[model samples]
Target: MKWKANTLSLRSLLCMPLTLIMLSTSITSAVIPVKTAYGEAAVDEQQVRTARSYQATLSDWKRWAADHAYALQTIQPESWSSNGGSIGQDKFSDLDILIPLLADKRIVYLGENSHGVAEFNLVKTRLIQYMHQTLGFNIVAFESGLGDAALGQGRIKKTATPDTMRRSIFGVWWTEEAKPLFEYMKETHKSESPLRLTGFDIQVQSPLFQNANWIPSIKLKDRALQAEQEVHKWRMSKDQSGFRKAKPELIKVYEELLQAVTKNENALKMDYPDEPHIVKLMKRALEDRIRVIQEFNELCIQSNLLTEQGDYSGAQSMMEWRDRAMASNLAWLVTEVYPEENIIVWGHNGHISKAQSLISTMPKSMGELMPKELQQESYVMGLFMGEGQAAENTREPIQLNPIIPGSMEDILAAVGQPYTFMDLRYRENERGNSWMFERMIASYQVQMPMPLELRRHFDGVLLIKQAKMPTYLPDTHK
Candidate 1:
């Protein structure tokens, strides 16, 4: 590779794994070694996937664009940079920048994948830097609510103890890799911290006290069964001919009870002290389902992504479970909202997808969740991996099966159709192999296609790439 020759430094040559050197002879050269954000050793091109022939040709990309009814020529790449350079060529995969679709009108949501922890953190760190410096975005919301609040408070002043700091600010669920970014924000931004972090997990945890599983499913079922029994009792007490006379009154009672439960934050606190917000929200969520019973099950099936033991039925059950929680959170955000501008959501790839994403489980899209005017002004971008060439191993054998060009049907047959490609890293295949496996190879696994419906809804798309390495923002202009 061009980068390997005359680029490898003495320090890097001494530091690179002996195994990698033996696997790729071209990598043994002299150049200055660049360290990662977390001070990890820099990786060379050999570590990335070997470049592959475009599986779907540029024509195929255009056709897929046409299939989606998008104006291919109209969807131009937006201008963006680390300092002021285009992505690829000299920057590391983790340091690439994404051009914003909404410019200042909306935020660019960067996703963090759970499977690849290190890669997730690297990209996250660079993204934080870019958003803060270039975009001047202020809020950094995580898959958490309470944690964000804690971080916000902590930033104002150090109220948390050392050991308790991370827990209070990010919650127990977050991985260690994600915390450094917050710390960096706190230190760099200080009282004027541009990167504010928050978490919904914390607020939910506060109410539940124990794990959500400890809520006792049987007890919940009993409550539902009791509500049904009451209804039956009311029906039996009235005469058949007079049923219509009492029907309105009986129905009114049930509706009133549901509303009361949903609004009674104090009642929720009595039952689940730690999770009053979750309980109150859940009540409202349940009412929503009861109002739309038939469609309820279908919505659930579409919202769930990963499951331990679930088919469509299981997905529905999971959705129903999550829907209530999501609704409750939404209610809180509605009533007790903060800044409307520059809010960044950090979550897993599945949750960020416009199609059946984690956020989709909510009553509305993240953009829709905002106030109507905010909805028009706000935008969302799901950061995803590209099949470009960042995921190759030198020791492995290369396989090449370029995708059949101009065939969305074939691409989806190999992968799935109605998909939107989100290549945040612009990684291509190194082994040059491409036969549609049911799942993606780990190297090229970060592909999350936007659904056809969602792609059309966006003002524009800002695909990120890391083709270049160790270069500044201005390099892209060259």
Candidate 2:
């Protein structure tokens, strides 16, 4: 997880004149004449001519590269200003140029390098609003727990104020900058034409009906409380010798709890027949929680077994399980919840990328495991910055270093723009167009030597000249 040093040396290695070096070696070795058919030493005229021709070709190529190396000017993006919050319909005219290209796409993925970039979050909010208003995109999915985000959505549906909705979101999205997005969603939701918000991640925030306030009847509330206590005991248990013996008991408790919740859902439905929306929302949220808890329980069981067997690598399966669960949940959302609706997915670049080019050894991202039909209907957009400040895991300020030479970011920075959008699908059929073939190589937590093929990995890239850390809201745990 170290940043690469001596980039100047790496650049020199990449730009080395291989043809000239090879020609020099050939010249030194060609001095000795070959024996002719008559046993007389003679210079092979054909071989000498071929070597001279190759040398001439190499010289021509060197001159061509020197002359055309700065051809990035030919691909300059249509300039647009991203100055403030005035990114409405009138200001979108310049960006309207991309509508035709994206019109057929069903799913548009917006990605960011880090979670705490103010500019990225702002731009994404603007883009989401514009897309939803203009392109009929209805569902907006986030990389958060389904139950927690759905609970937030329900609150919004009930016209919750911005501050209340802000507190409802879990994880990194709980920031001051994200408040505007929630407020916008609340203002936009209508009984006749509602704008839906959902999450497709696998991390569960809280179990359904764990609090007494959520259950209507005292009997049901007491049942939920007893189940929660038992589940907690199982989770906090440290007696390995009795772990296997407790599995059946744990399963029985889970099943009973699920049945109790299901019974409560039916009871609420009958009691609140005039107000079915709340009941439906609670039921869906409970179902999402159940799925996540079941997955987690299975993961714990497998990890414990692996630990007993002395195979610690099996612990990593938990991540694979989470990823697979996320993908499956997204697929279910698309097929069952919002069929025939175009969706916008927002997450970190690593999670939404079509391939794990950033982390070569990691499991396939959610986009990678998507069904082929869904894949064809998707367009992945990656966001990158040249230089900026970001927050480390410890919330300490860290700087984004200058672009490395011969990298995709370096070539884009040469365009000398504050912001630009490049469609990677554009391919040029010209020689010496290394920029078109060079892949995107980036590093965050670790130094990644392998580069992602721009055309194959991402449909487009949004490049910002500089970035700054987002202003986080007060920590929820605090």
* Candidate 1 similarity to native, TM-score: 0.41
Model 2 scores a TM of 0.70
Residues 349-392, candidate 2, lDDT per residue (tens digit)? 76777876345556667878788899888878877777788665
lDDT of 1 at 289: 31
Q: Which window of 10 residues has the lowest lDDT sum in candidate 1?
A: 468-477
lDDT for 363 in candidate 2 is: 63
Residue 283 deviation, candidate 2, in Å?
Answer: 5.5
Candidate 1 lDDT over 234-287, as tens digits, reads 322313334345445444544654655555645444543322244434444344
Task: Give the residue spans of candidate 2 off by over 4 A.
Answer: 1-88, 157-168, 190-192, 210-214, 217-257, 260-316, 357-359, 426-439, 444-450
State how far residue 435 of model 1 sits from its true place (Å).
19
Model 1 alpha-carbon drift over 4 Å, by segment:
1-102, 112-115, 147-176, 201-311, 320-336, 339-341, 355-372, 386-478
